[model samples]
Target: MEGLKECVANLVVYLHPSKAKCPNEAILTELSSMLFTYNETFEGVVLAYDPGNCSNLAKILPGIHPYFGVKLTARILLFNPKPDMLLEGEVVKITPHSIHAVVLGFSAAVIADEDIRGEFKYKSKHGKEVYVSKSHKKHKIKVGTILRFVVKSFDEEILHLSGSLLADHSGCARWLDKNSDKWSQADRF
Candidate 1:
């Protein structure tokens, strides 16, 4: 808001089509500069682009603008997830049936009780008497536990993360050994 001149952000910019009308290099350079300037507001932020996330994401405004003969409107589209790697998150909810977690600035993910670890379960506090794993009696899933997971699946917004320590947890006993490195720094995540 400081030194910005009185530039009318019409949200519509017309582009020339052919080199006969406007040279390609000239248009490309000029348009690129304009786009980058405006797109600064969109940098590093996720936008609702698809119908899965928001149905009105790409919907046009109530006004109409025609270029030469064709009509034009605005739209919001998604960018790919960055770095293409596994991410860590905190388990926000722990239950007898499933574990709900969230990645930082992302979406909620789920790890079913059966999918959490190799044959792991905890007795529910309500005590309806369901099958519980005896081995997991010592280590129970609790809130705010940092869990490493991979993005199993994702749409525009929803995420399905899996806590499958496929390579790390080679065996049950090894898991206990690796995870029990120290109890002093419990809140490391």
Candidate 2:
């Protein structure tokens, strides 16, 4: 949620000659192709889009196969994560060496052993594996838990993220919210 941003874009969509009869539909299909994929021009993954006004007049290219360009405006939502940014994700898997999570129900994230701070200890009880904070017993991270972590690196090609729980503000989101006062006090020292 922290990295989600919405912005307006003015774009020109080129439609093939066959789709000249239905230019609007062709434009919609072209915009749909951009969803859920990382675009360098946008600098993030496109989540959703709303196409705005379209010009009735189109410019047709003077080539063997005529292609027409339709100009339109659109609002798009993007997920752009940056280093040292705090993010929240749901834990999907856990191991002694790492924790796997999904951010915003789409992007994948992994918190490796070296990135986990010393305060949290990996434990197994009744066949369930979890990371429990030694400093605060109530703070725990297990499968299905919502975790807050700092972004170490992000792979745009695969939408994979490497995260860290080394910061005081990074941990179990529920625990952090419940103990906000106590957490702030700890941050002071």
Candidate 3:
């Protein structure tokens, strides 16, 4: 199924607060299913932010805002599917310095060593090969990995990267869409 994408102005997450009857597992499972469904049906782009979690909302929303393209707002509902399909334990955790978003079956790069003990190398955007510890190695990665990295530490230019490694030239953000007037404006100016 094709993924859904929509711009959201505000997302209101209803939490039970009391985890006695409605557990966090139930809540996260519902949320994940909803996100998957939304990602499959919507198009254009999607921007979601929860008002309840103000601090975290602030951090992620700003980072994703400029990439939404034309979408402005949207809403999605979440509900538990079944007992066996529930999400148990913490699915996402956010602290002052970092935010960790977890998925049950997340695939990431893993070492291909036969000895069961070795380091794995991952190439960063800067062309620097970084070695991951044996314990930190992953087997594969999902199409889009949830990174819990610090937003402040890295240089901002990395975020503006465009095009493939073969073509080191930039100014290709609107390359896929020839109808964009932004290109005309750039020519005129």
Cα TM-score per model: 0.39, 0.97, 0.19
Write one digit per residue (lDDT tens) for candidate 3, span 42-157.
Answer: 32122232322222221112352322111113344322122112121111332222223332232111212231122323334454223233323432112233321111111122
Model 1 agreement with the true structure over 1-189: per-residue lDDT tens digits = 011122212133333343325433433443345331224344322333211111112223343542222122334332223322344556677666766777554556666655554545555566432323344454444566665544454443333345442323211332345666532243364
Off by over 4 Å in 3: 1-6, 9-25, 34-38, 44-163, 170-189
C-alpha lDDT of all candidate models, in order: 0.41, 0.94, 0.26
Residue 53 in model 1: shift from native, Å? 30
Please report the TM-score between candidate 2 and the true structure.
Answer: 0.97
lDDT of 2 at 175: 95
Q: Per-residue CA lDDT of candidate 2, range 93-125, in tens?
A: 999999999998899999999999999999999
* Winner of 1 and 3 under lDDT: 1
Colliding residue pairs in candidate 2: none
In candidate 2, position 148 carries an lDDT of 97
Ranking by TM-score: 2, 1, 3
